[model samples]
Target chain A: LGPVMIVDTPGMDDEGELGLLRIEKCKEVMAKVDIAILVVDGTLGMSDGDRMLKKMFEERNLPYITVYNKLDLVQQRIGKGRTREVPQDSIWVSASDKINITDLKDMVAHLVVDPSNGRKIIADLISEGDIVVLVTPIDEAAPKGRLILPQQQTLRDILDTGAIGVVTQVPQIPEVLASLAKTPALVVTDSQAFKEVNELVPEDILLTSFSMLFARYKGDLGEAILSANYLDKLEDGAKILISEGCTHHRQCNDIGTVKLPKMIEKTTGKNFHFEWSSGDSFPDDLSTFDLVVHCGGCMLNPREMMHRIRICQNAGVPITNYGVIMAKMQGILPRVSAPLLGKK
Target chain B: LGPVMIVDTPGMDDEGELGLLRIEKCKEVMAKVDIAILVVDGTLGMSDGDRMLKKMFEERNLPYITVYNKLDLVQQRIGKGRTREVPQDSIWVSASDKINITDLKDMVAHLVVDPSNGRKIIADLISEGDIVVLVTPIDEAAPKGRLILPQQQTLRDILDTGAIGVVTQVPQIPEVLASLAKTPALVVTDSQAFKEVNELVPEDILLTSFSMLFARYKGDLGEAILSANYLDKLEDGAKILISEGCTHHRQCNDIGTVKLPKMIEKTTGKNFHFEWSSGDSFPDDLSTFDLVVHCGGCMLNPREMMHRIRICQNAGVPITNYGVIMAKMQGILPRVSAPLLGKK
Candidate 1:
């Protein structure tokens, strides 16, 4: 049994058309996606990308729901005489406020999935008491007092599965596994730390990242993570483009710049030339690059992200995002994502 | 001899692909533009659009100076860990910050028209005795106790012209002209008040709006205003999309909503299905409509706006923005846009 999730991406900003890439990646996975969650800013209402993604889902017949995020910013808009809007097939929920999260999950209960894809909804994925270990790093970008939205959502999803969830960091994972009498059913680590977790964990232990699950849930796991294979084919000094969605609190030691480059160098053991572009500086032509590594794109629209992926494909460049690449590099490419990407 | 001016546009969230559009449009008017005033937001560093515009200027071999606007917002960004960024060929001045207006004009003293266009720099176009009447409508959208940025810029442009700027409302323009001994050289009305002002101005006077000047400044004046000719040919029930560039100060009885619609209806004198979309909502298929009425698109990148225009062109739908449409409707299209758009 496994869990299904969705990732709503932001606009083309935060990396020139990075959202477009994610949208293309999402479409690749949409065929098997169990639940499509569209996240939008309540203050801005539905953006061009939001409406475009919804149209994409309608065309694809994806079972999707919408979450109006950032309701805390509502008072300001309301003070200005603007009303909060929930467009069709959507519910308002502030990711920070944790409002209506229960309703959100409950709606997922009646949600339909692609029968051929055999995506086991969380209800069918796990029985009570299955062990789920969340491996997250306490990095500078990690908020001071609390975990970020995606981490919190994953923990909640794990709890909803009735799975016994244990949270640990990459360094603590080997010790945590030593003490566990039974191997955990699943280990979801921060994508940034997935490589090390994979090295220490046994081959049988389930390993994945929130992003990997997101890729599978959104129906892009294979096409997205497969870009990691590009590492082998890349020419020496080849240009690589990496992009992320959010700009706020973008740390100086960003994974897009520091860790991912190190990982690629370690995985291929080659000093591959890299060009790091973030927030909305996505280059127009992706053809020049050997491969493109992208972030989760939580803040971007799914359509724009997909458009970017299609651009890479059209340009004949291999493209993958953080989590999918992490899962592949971490060596749990299958068991971690098989439940969702696998054919029935 | 009126004050002829050029305007630099702002980027639409995604809609203002004006940078790319202008590049293509510039190909037609590269030799025609009298001055190129490159614009950059004072708060948001040199954006991709800005870079693209700069590249276009370089490629076209156009003489351009930069205008860094929104100085008031610059300080706000400083506190938010953001600092002022100035690209070359640009001067940093807050259009909002008083007393720097003269400095902007002084910088413009260096403008050199592309020799091919044969258009003279605006500063040389003005005569000492010409009375330049500016029709400024203080609408709800107008900031409290202050004129809009465009108005303020126009006033400065008038002073630089050495033409006496006779400021008045549309209703008072006739009286002001009568009071003056000589026929005014030009009458620049707010695009929203073009119809009323058009009738009051004599044939010898130049008539235009800021939007018209912007169209010329962006090097697409003729093409944009030409789209308005198709208004009469539009099907009765044919869809018409009206889109604005940004989401700023949507005043009650906004010009986009109230005046543009009323004026268009009065000019066409026929009912047509109308759909109003603002901000970055323009989809790729503008061909579904008989005509697309767009705003000045000051807030969008030229590439994005051109994308819409190209879409409509490909779809066989005529597209015109606010000022262009207004001029055409008044039957004084060429005259209103003439000084800047050329003696059409």
Candidate 2:
């Protein structure tokens, strides 16, 4: 259990091949999760896909709850029985109606390592009143009126951590840190801005990306960071697949298109070939790829990312996402993720 | 050859379950029809799916010219003997760029029934100067800026048949027909407006919906009509899936949401049950369902629709779409589709 819980879920019915890619993702999330919640549209009765997932849970021996989302669309907690294969404890929850939410909280709470047991990485990190600073860049793709779901979620989780989370814009981060009375417990920066943020943050402060937690949560932190190190080895003319879970025009600063390639070349001193695909177009035949670097997957579920991660692993191709690689390159990989390992 | 062209198609990559249904549909189309054109997306490059369709053509000895689409999106065609698998004489086309359209015309003209032959269906039905009255009801689901694709296509086919097609709104159909010389050669209508239009067309005059052409073009008239009759047998509380190809709401008559179920029950003389889903959701499991009703598939490619059709057929479930069933109920089946079929 860490102070942050990053999710990587894709939508049910996407435009193209991306929709199917999301299915691979669900499996990834289940494989690494200590506690898993399978969510369904509340208004729509449980679908066959949901049933299929619960059976997967039974096979994997992962504990799970069936969360009925968008309760605001429908009020009833329409229930169904667990498959003969799964545990009888399958639950129904609604995030929009706030119905059965307490049940979800209790399920997650139970998954948390006991306080006396001192098993949670997140729980251990909080020295009551510790101020953790979150650095977020306000890019145009960050929705027109509000923060993206992941950022809002991070804010809520910070509140749950019982620590003062001083949210600061990336530019204000330096001033915010200098004015603080105490050395901050942590500084989490976006993967796109990590290189600069790492230079400014002191050696003692923990730094990581939301993507890093997801890599750990989905069970591949060590391998992903190692794969990311390949950024240093990208030879000129090497093909790089910069994949994103969602779509956006003008992805500010060209993180996938321009910056990552520059960083790869700067760090490894290798000229690299780059092509970008956003929203569900990772080719199945990946034998031709030299390296694949992905986003933090704020829009995707852990299950899908892990599937892609596994794809690379199965193909003998190196695959890594933004944050884990950034953290590893900066030399704070363990200090950032070790907090969430829960004795394992 | 009349305007009709029955086609057999291949399956989608992940839609393995749809194979049997598509094969059945292909067989149904093969059993009828005067001509067939196998359309292929050229820019994307033909793969196994196209190969499978080619095998079907070979097995049936059906004469077909590959209408390669989206030529505008590709670089120069690699030229003859490149793939070795594809026909050397295949015509390149671009629906988007309107390139090589005459090649398609020449191909269809050569491969299809001899249009000059007195044995052709359209020639036998309407002389060069004959008038054809078309009934099309415009509604919200009707594309705001243009005519629906099928109706526009049917009108073009009618023109190519050398008959003057007088188009009219459904309510204005009676007035327009009254003013025409004698009875019009044919009467075509939107199936949703079948009831009112059926009453207006004389018993001897030809009448059909835009959907009927799709049914015959895809080659499954009898089975489609028969499967749709399953709606009559559904229990009051029975589950029926009314699926559509697109995500947008029906613009007029609230057809899928309100009208179709009512007509199903009205014709069944019983309170038949109905449920609806639009956009990529075609149920995989059908053991719980009594029947499946699909739309005419204005938005889906043959590859995807045939997959859904196959799922129902393989599961031993009856399946039919809007136009075929409406044609049967209105008793105008043979006449509307006569344009596509030549004498044996």
Candidate 3:
């Protein structure tokens, strides 16, 4: 019972429309669980319905333990040791007297297995005491009173690695660089300010963006880079889906809805059909679209993000994010992603 | 005006406590914007407050356009063609008469820049018509009525890539493999079933788990693998944070709260202080913990997920997820992650 979900499903032997519906619901619930517990009335032993349930669990490869409840009644009726046969893994318990419940709980806990992995932001890229410069341009779209999640996280990662992080704005990059004792180990800028920061930061120092770092950290960097090339292949009337992970209030000049579409059209010099999707609902079928351009997924979990990428992959459609596309369009994709990608 | 957010803040010249607080709020608003529109009264021309606001914009590198409103009043008072000098980008308009608004909107749109990149699931791994076997063990935790997001996504990705995905349960995996015309290009199982699936799948064929693929797709697989080794380094009384991205109803036998903690304790043979965090609130200060074990982050966006990783990295704490840890604990990490990592 510890950390385990106990679903009290409807009787498997129920009949008629409502009963059938209940059984159907039970089946649906059955599809998702890791372990099953079949509680049987000990006096009656296993019924046909219980057998069907057991078979269902077996077919699904579900590990289960049978619980024979009302053990006192069974014991009294069968004279103790003469009780009916049961599965080896089955346990006998008296619900009223609380018999063998602890044993049942232990068995259940043992069957509940863990399935999981881990990650890092930029901690691996630099050494202790290394100076890391971050160019965060405060604009109308910047969050009020604090840095956005990505910036705060990047700086924290630097601190975690025992490294120095020099935070500055776009216009102050040159001054920040000039004031440094030695060339910083890495210069990470907001994707929107990459072009300006690229010119200001020395050619020898490694440079990247919050978006680019996230592209690799939370998603597939290599696939995003490859998909960026799809921009060139876009033909007239090509279909594109512009997807944003979170549905924040639309600003007058929202990047995903306005600027990105405009940029895509202007860059390709081709007319195309543009579609937009926001929040948790991504279309199941992505095959209709020639390309999918997504925002840096700050709001979505890794599994959802990867699922999206998988959807695009299955559809045979190329997908890129706002940062990678902007870098590619600005002709700095390679230069900005170099530090993270471990390439020149 | 299209998709742009217009925040009307208190006067920049405001003084005193409440007034200063209003101005502080205004400054907070200014930090997040892409562009600024300074509306000056034509009758008043440019006041000292206006100059200060413009200077703030310039210092922050915010592109702005000034509008001289009540042009009719200014022209009537000062005579036509005798207006006060203004910046080159300033526009003269009569607000009541709806003058030059289109041009102002265009200017604002021109200032909004797109900053973004992009991903894939298993579509990148399997080819068209390739048979990919999926071993999903249905248990009590399975969601009612439909497949979980990850499974649905993987299946969809298979269809998208023009590949054949044979979905089966763990007990039926042997039959599934036996029935196949030839060896499947890959066999992906739930991480919980990795041990059994690892034994069943042939060494000649590629094998991995959905969690392993996602670890790479949505996060750093190498980092996860490295962090998994940290399990061996855990000492008695070491603090561990078991973080989950979403806060679903805790089942009687919840994996994160019950199974995982118990498993860690059993595997390490050490007593540890375990803490928990779920949903959007990850502790900003994670330095107190020796290690952080996180869920796969299906509910969190990539940015937030990566941010948590960054936080852990910054805290100098080793972090691993449910899938990777399970594989590691079961001694099947190498076998389960091989196909995705491109090594055996």
Per-residue CA lDDT of candidate 3, range A243-299, in tens? 988787453129888888898889888999999998766887998999998898875
By lDDT, the better pick of 2 and 3 is: 3
Q: What share of the true interface contacts does candidate 1 keep?
A: 0.00
Residue B134 in candidate 1, Cα distance off native in Å: 69
Off by over 4 Å in 1: A1-125, A178-181, A249-253, A265-273, A280-284, A301-304, A326-344, B1-344
DockQ of 2: 0.01
Interface RMSD of each: 35.0, 32.2, 25.2
lDDT of 2 at A173: 57
Per-residue lDDT value at B263 in model 1 = 73
**Most accurate candidate by TM-score:** 3
* lDDT tens digits by residue: candidate 1, A1-344: 12334444435233456766876666655643555787777777777777777888899767788878776678555654344655566777767767677877777766743332544323244555565666766654654324455555454444444444455556656655655566667777777766687787787776667786655543355678578766677776888888765566465237788878888789877787888766555666877788888787664445446656777788988878887776666666665676445432
Model 2 accuracy (lDDT, Cα)? 0.62
Fraction of the true interface contacts (Cα pairs closer than 8 Å across chains) found in each model: 0.00, 0.00, 0.00
Greater lDDT among 1 and 3 belongs to 3
**Candidates' C-alpha lDDT:** 0.63, 0.62, 0.74
Using DockQ, give the best candidate's number: 3
Using TM-score as the yardstick, the better of models 1 and 2 is 2
lDDT minimum window of 10 residues, candidate 3 chain B? B110-119
